[model samples]
Target: MPMVDTGDVRLHVQRMGPRDGHPAVGTVLLVHGLLTDSLASYYFTVAPAFAAAGLDVVMYDLRGHGRSGRPPTGYTLDDAVDDLAALLDRLAVTGPVHLVGNSYGGTVAFGYAARHPERAASVSLIESEPATAAWAAKLDGILRRVQRELAYNETDALAWITVNRGHNTARLARGAARLARETTLVRDIPASSVLTEDGMRAVGCPVLGLYGGDSDLAALVPWLEASLPDCRTVVVPGHEHSVLVEAAGTVGGHVLALIEGSGGRGPGRVSIPGGGGGRASGAAGPAVR
Candidate 1:
């Protein structure tokens, strides 16, 4: 429940690993997807692997998304990017960082790294799409559904979520539903980010794009992996938008590979454990999808 004042806003953030770890090599920042918080959405899986691999982990709720302050306005992705820069500045942990982002979080990471190329040591993106023309209509469709669910105090919305996302716990489903209707500060942030694709070409660091082989968004993998000069991607089979949890080991391997590649420590070979792989050309070579 630690809150840091990022000058413009107070952000709710959490950390893992030893306090004594050096910021340069051990710090990682985990950015959660659209409607969830740092703890509930990201910490359960991604953070631990980094911590176990001798790195410190940091995560914060985007404004209005989790335990962070729900501002009356300012939910744009640029706002989120500013929030991230503000937090990093506040912590003073200035080093090329290892960034892991999921869904909209991935776009946020992409935006930040593109805007501030010097701050990234490496990056990992899961179930994420580059800011492209393909995203506008897709976002409209998601927002329309989200708005429709909110029109009735979220009863129908909750039901729709339950039927569609039945794999999540009841508490998580309800919590997400409640956040949808009650939190307004972070709404439209993801949709707004879809309006730009110029930023997509700005990324120049080692990056891994993650998606479920079965997910609808998986189709965008080729465009992104090939476009970025130093980027590649992996797709987990039999999973969808929820690739992080559905395929933790495979996802974990990719995260590890990205970190290793960033540090110039490739393992000589990467094994998928139980999923398929995609090939891309870059300094790091092809990795497990």
Candidate 2:
């Protein structure tokens, strides 16, 4: 459970790969969604695939989520990206590194790429949308539904989870309840800055947009194609918003391809001369969820 000081808050970060101390072909940062989501989603899903494919893997629990420090405020999109910049600086992860984000995490990656194009090798969004007004509106709808259906109080949420979703989903539901009760996420997110169309267009790197064929966010593919000059879009049939969880293997293959295609080449990739089999250096603190 190593934490990195971002000047503003402490972030729980996990780096994984072979411990052989091999230099990685490139670096890939995995960003998870909001609420109950944490680095564990990626850690258990696509991360190991990237690691085995000879890329450095970095995953962190976003502020106010998981083991990261949760402040009373500063849950805005801009704030999240700034925290990412500071973490990268602290870790001395120079050059253009791949950013792979799921759900709201994709918005963070998009914001970061827009602000720091020079530092981004490529950006991948899984079941995510650009932080546009439309997306904000959609988010509002989802939140409204959540408020109406789910309990914000820990006790009630746990009770609902146990009765409805059983033990497995209850675990995640409990975490979500804790975050809702303890943090300002529900309030801060609505007030967070949204990315304008101009902002989305400003990102100067290749983009990969993956969405479920039936997902509410599926429209984002056409949007990306119309906006980004170098964007690739993929739609997984028979899936919905939970593509990252339901179809992780398919998603992992796409990510590995991206790393192989862009993460080991010229300026976009960071070459680590002979160090073992392209393993990223372990974080200073022990790896934790």
What is the lDDT of every predicted structure here? 0.67, 0.73
**TM-scores for all predictions:** 0.81, 0.82
Model 1: CA > 4 A from native: 18-24, 162-187, 190-198, 262-289
How much is the lDDT of residue 221 in candidate 2?
64
Find the 10 residues in a row with the least total lDDT in model 2: 280-289
| Model 1 lDDT tens row, 1-289 | 7999987778899888744554435577888776533445656665665666667788988776667876666777778889999999998877778888888788787778878988987778887765565665666677568668667657666666654542444555566665666655325554555434456566777888777777777776666766777777666566777767656656766687778664333323323333222232222223332
Top lDDT hit: 2
Over 4 Å off, model 2: 148-168, 262-289
RMSD of each: 4.7, 9.1
